[model samples]
Target: MRRFDSAQPILAGLVSAVVGYASSFTVVLAGLRAVGATPAQAASGLLALCAGIAATAVFLALRFRMPISIAWSTPGAALLVATGHVQGGWPAAVGAFLVCAALIVVAGLSPWLGRAIAAIPRPIAGAMLAGVILSLCTAPVRAVVDVPALAIPVVLAWAVLTRFARQWAVPGALLAAVVAIAVRGVHLTGVSIAPAAVLTVPTFNLPALISIAVPLFLVTMAAQNVPGMAVMATYGYTPPLRGVLVTTGLASAFAAPFGGHALNLAAITAALTAGPDTHPDPRRRWVATAALGAGQLTLGLGAGLAMALVLLSPPVLVIAVAGLALLSALGASLASAVTDPSGREAAVVTFVVTASGTTILNIGPAFWGLVAGGLTALLLYRRTRPSSPPDPTPPSPAATELPSPTAAGPAASR
Candidate 1:
């Protein structure tokens, strides 16, 4: 018997995995390299991330009996890319990764921490995410300007595909990019096919912990996990927040020694599996998420191949494809951040400061963006707001005046 009566769910799952993987793996690779991972180690890290998230997604879906999709922290990867070289190199980065995982675990176990994270204003969160992805979203334009011949076809393909099959746009663009790269005779020489797990003995560094781990944890929670829960809620499936957090945290820790930075609830791809289009019956959508996990696992096994393929491409091409993938996410975040008049200024401030790439006291722009936005919002809104009376509770039926039953009785009428 088929696990799911409808194949739509299964198909949706497969597509989610493909789109998710193809979209952001380059960013992961670039981030790992920036943090001092050798090419071989970076490949191992990518594989470990895929495997860890795959396992986490499967476990969470089965445990919760919901379509809870898990994903690597793309925003966190972008953070790492922005941070570049740290004080202790890759070993220190590994230590920071472990710290991030531990923090996530604590957030899961401690109600106070979870509440604190949840208390973050939605506008600030959206703006911070938008800022983080701003650079990435510009890659398409830069790539086109830098290499028109290679980028134009990919962009055109994405535009055409998006018009028809919106879901397949990114992957379609990626296919076009691959063809463009191949036609240009990009050499594949010197690319290694061997997939080896390179373990880094983590070295504790306070600077790395403060800079990388703190920002990573914040971004993963605010940008990915929080919105991920919203996505699930949209489909009326509310999985336990703690369980999801703990599962992804442990997975991130497990993969850290081999190069993975962080894993969390997936926001973008979750829609593919959780939406009504996946299946008419929401109860059976877990099968689609499971299929997604299986697909991710299969791709994880081919991490070496993925690494080789990426290595063969020019950096511009890789980033351009990645930019195309993130355009939708960027647009959505911007729209959401400024949708409300109350928070518009704060959100814009957050977006500008974060996108500015400013670092203060060794902390990155993302952290500062949230702080500035929150403070600005508090100050701005408090000054202009008028005092209002508290709403009164409604009267109970027994307390309210009503027509007496005796007055309407048949005996009285007679």
Candidate 2:
């Protein structure tokens, strides 16, 4: 009993890592591929991301003695898929990755830049995220129509497990996808399981920078890092913001040449390790994230195998799993995008433009969406502003008077 009790946090950490990795790896792979990474380069990117996430999680957890979970930016990956191929190919995308990492570092070092990011209106941010992921989120439905034999079982498994074991739903779906792929028989003749990294000489181009780097940075900061801090706060833990941003930024830089796009603080997975459910004593929760590091390291060793499986499997099946993984995020983003009546129009404009996936002047839709939303918000707000301040009238005695204790209701009496 004593041994099992001590192992709880460790087990929770492992579970968190597994859930985090299995949930959206396909999104990462698809994103890398869509941006022009070859199969080997994409596999390398996955490996690099796993390594960066593991190193960051373990170091932060131990150094801070807090459950500071780290993760690859999943929404950023979805944004990549939406952006599609860049002008300068994989190397240019890599340069964009480097630029994003530098921006993250600067955001940490410069208070003004951090504030600027925070100043990006929440509704616009949420709407942009929603739009970027809209198509990917619909891939499961498309998969059902295109490949029922492979897709149906995966969806059913995810749906059933979501009803009973919510955290395991995506992993279960991934497992089902693997089973379906194996049964369907895929050729894996020359695929290698040994982990390896492929270096690309990064080249900078205006198109890639505007199309990929800027939007990727925005999505990662808004969707992952900010929410990650909020999750820690919810668990009564104050993360080391400067340390986290700098460390993750540096790690992302290290992995960028190997094709990893970005790494950031984990939000959804952080809750698994940081919450009271992981350990009754809050102080012990850091052990869970430490264990998560180990789990990620172990998984990193198998990146080649994972990528091989993904490459060999039917494209629609893997895409369907990625779509299923993002459904919850999409729902949350949409809700947040339209939650405030004042910002609803701007948010809707952002969403429509982003979902359209149109490019103008070589820049992607995500950037244009923000521009449109920001302009709409400015116009609407300026038009609605009062010409003069309202008079500060005093309240009447009757209006200001408190209700009787009895009239206040039963709870008030108690």
Candidate 3:
């Protein structure tokens, strides 16, 4: 068993767990509600999703030589919300979960897919990532339209502070928004607040997989997995793609019955573990991912208490906190996307398309954003430099032989 000398993995894991869970949970709740989940059902379902990500984050991060954290697919939420509206019930969504899990596992195990992931140009991948985040960044703003007096100014204030102040922008903006909401006396009077109960047993049936399981699986993979690995690579942590996919698959496979539809590598949550804040030695920090699993277990056990807290907090708080928490990550990706002169235009196109929230055939924008960005990169940046590839050879546990992801490509498929 491999391990690191620094205590940073443990420290990073603790912080990453709390911040990532809280932020991602908000999205998960939105996802449940979008699917018309009862308030208690929504809380329990989000807890399950967190449980899945936390498990994968810990297992894969510990085994792989990178700070590999997992996260829920926020983009998938948009797709599922639409899916829930059309599909008739949660059974179809669960079916999507099962199918997506199978797909994720298959993709993880397949070397061709891993090769394909690695082959994508950095500029294109960066653009796709920006596209994903930009969409999420704008969600709070658009939510205001649903509750204009409430969601609008909160988003606008966040934008203004972010544009003007820069450093303290996200936190400050979130705080300001919270204060604004409070001043206006917007309370959750109609919202249900009773403690949520957990569904210990998973609901399963073959027919349900078709309507709910398959699409949810596709949405999770398209929206979450590909872009997440990109973020890991962007920051220079190159863990095995096979390991991650397998972990995500296992997580979802287990979580699906519990109504956790989407669980994969978390680009946003990963920033906490992948950045300079985690560890100077990339190899040392993978343990932190494992720690997240521990955190998930902790959260799962006390979900009733967690729901109590959520019921009390304002909706704007969730958006503002998530927006702020992701600001650093968002900036880093945007910087990566446009820094290369050749890839600049393609990246911009990717960002705009993703941010647009336009859907085709009910598929969300992340898929199209990646498609558009990849095509643009293909057309504009034809001269892609493929550095010396990793030796397509047998495994070695010794640290030196482990090729850096940036040095070679995304994780080598099994």
Give the residue spans of candidate 2 off by over 4 A: 386-414
Candidates in order have lDDT scores of 0.83, 0.90, 0.61
In candidate 3, what are the lDDT values of residues 119-179, reduced to their tens digit? 6556556655565555456556556655666566656665686689553444454455556
Q: After superposition, how far is residue 145 of candidate 3 from its true place, in Å?
A: 6.9
Model 3 residue 139 lDDT score:
55
TM-score, cand. 2 vs. native? 0.93
Give candidates' CA RMSD values in order: 10.6, 7.0, 10.7
Cα lDDT tens digits, model 2, 29-54, are: 99999999998899899999999988
Model 3 residue 71 CA deviation in Å: 1.5
List TM-scores for all candidates, in order. 0.87, 0.93, 0.62
For each predicted model, how many residue pairs clash, with residues at least 3 apart or on different chains? 0, 0, 15
> Which candidate leads the pack in lDDT?
2
Specify the highest-TM-score model's number: 2
